[model samples]
Target: MRYGTRALLSKALLSLLLMAACGAQAHFQELIPSTDILTAETGNTLALSLKFTHPMEQGPVMSMAAPRRFGVMGPRGQEDLIDRLRPGGTDGKRTFQATYRAELPGDYIFFVEPAPYWEPAEGVMIVHYTKVIVDAFGAEQGWDQEIGLPVEIIPLVRPYGLWTGNLFRGIVKQDGKPVPFAAVEVEWRNDGSVTPPSDPYITQVVKTDANGVFSYAMPRSGWWGFAALLEGDTPLKSPDGDSVPVEAGALMWVQVRDMR
Candidate 1:
């Protein structure tokens, strides 16, 4: 093998790796509900959509397998909704969807534990525990209930019915305990009206304080996703038959409304 040929090959490989890393920067597990706060006028049944993607970019959606677990935790208790998920998609991309009737007036916290995704570019498996809270008929009780996920964001403020400028706050928890100084990445779901000026503007980031709590006031009205990332304690087998670290994320989606 000629030295010049080897050098060219190495440069090409480096370019490809850099591109992959940039693509993985804003990966988010989205568990978005039709309406964050449900009312009689809004509708009786709530619809939820689950997907993995770069929310702000809103394209190049990564394929998602059937979730490992899906359910809701409410005033009554946790209910297993794994069987309720149905295949859904848009523009030929795979996604999951579910519908539930708001039987009682209370807060319904919907969550999904997605199957591990193998990312060869990053050389790690990604699994995100994602959730969203829906308040039914103004019964705000149980919005703060912890569902005992492997990783999660327990909201400090009411998760639903917020004005655009309200401060959204939460505590990053893993194994039901606070993760002090955890890092959180925030992104707005772009609806084609706004274009990011640069890669950094696509995803905003913040760090938890000593108490494992963080806050961000959304300036716009729409769905905002917060992902608190943690390195998994255990490694998973990769496609290449090697052990690789896992990137476990605690993700929660909240919606803000514009004042009339």
Candidate 2:
């Protein structure tokens, strides 16, 4: 009886550890544009979608509230786009969409600052500062422009028009200063074609150097998301009115094309 009880206790502890590891796996705030590189022939406008999810898992999407802030930084400068956001969804989960007319020949960086989300499993409030770049009319200038987000990834490589297998690098910044030795998570948007052989394959992790820069090479052609996570200095109130830590994430999305 003693041995049996010990075995049962061990199993319970292992199960709890597995559950925690799965919960810790990476939740991404996705802000993806309809197209990364927009040609003149494509159209005069762009459609952007926003969601919070585990991208590599293809999701059980976490419902997103209306963003706290939304805007675009382009050749002319930043413009408020909060009013343009429309309600959208998939699989019964609430999401957001925005349509913007591209009147300039330059790179447009679309950004979203989501409202704080309480994750019961993690016992923290999550706020992801998400952005994506769309190059318009063959004008590649301004892809690196900073939107002055609280936490952001300023791309060392142009965020759009990339081929698979190319190295992508970005600097993780908080309040315009590099966040040394930051942790960044990378995941590919699963299109239902690939499956992870193990749990670790779902979200790839990398750490920034002392200068707050990290790099990864894209192995497959698809939309890739990079999230640099930092703990906020201030705690927020949970749904239960308890004070909880805030997980502030800097997220960026970029699309890669196949050689074919």
Candidate 3:
């Protein structure tokens, strides 16, 4: 081949490569539940849809999960509920959807990953969480702090029958009294030692109820450490009405046994 022709071909190939890279980056255009608030009822399915810039390639494995490193903080700056993403609908188009039931009411967050063709086409995607308010009718009552009631998770024994794992719950309190509308987080550590809880195992967060209670269930059968945190913009008021700062990383430990 001529020298000039060879040089032109190399440049053209490089340009094509760059264009392909850019296209892949744009695949994830936006998340459907983009708003900071999501309203749903207890036992009702919450659908989270992801809109891509282009139609996703067929056979690409897409999955979603809650944030492994962080937990949801309630309005009082305390961890409230257990949050998780259950697999939902998969339409071979510019969008993908995941459905999760709103077990309780309060704020929550989820981390989603869309990987097409087994390659790291996209990095970690975070979907800002919103409040899921459940009413007596089992329907979303919209966002209203006046009638807002915190939701709690109650463990129903391991579904598998024989598994040793940790159980976690979120607690919201105000003036030494539990906050019913506060969010709670309970994380399970895979390692038996509980000096501090780390990552990998399933974590759940839930909001407290009018009575102030939230719970989380772990899948694995073993010893684990747990942490509870309550977070919110509103400063917690003391008995004297003094505002207090809310922070993360409040932790504790619990022993889970396999009775099955």
Best by lDDT: 2
TM-score of 1: 0.90
- TM-score per candidate: 0.90, 0.91, 0.26
Which residue pairs clash in candidate 2? Answer: none
lDDT of 1 by residue, 95-155 (tens): 9989998888999999999999998867778899998999999888999988888898999
**Which stretches of model 2 miss by more than 4 angstroms?**
1-23
The local distance difference test score of model 2 is 0.87
Per-prediction count of colliding residue pairs? Answer: 0, 0, 26
**Which 10 successive residues of model 1 have the least lDDT summed?**
14-23
lDDT of 3 by residue, 155-237 (tens): 22221122354444445443344656443433333243433233212334455577766565655544222222333223344
Question: Candidate 2's residue-wise lDDT over 1-260, tens digit each?
Answer: 69999767754553353345344667888888889888867986888889888899888798988899999999889999999999898889999998999998999999999999888877778899999999999989999988898899999998887999999999999989999987788999999999999888998888899999999999999999998878676779999999766778899999999988
Candidate lDDT values, in order: 0.86, 0.87, 0.35
Comparing candidate 2 with candidate 3, which one achieves the higher lDDT?
A: 2
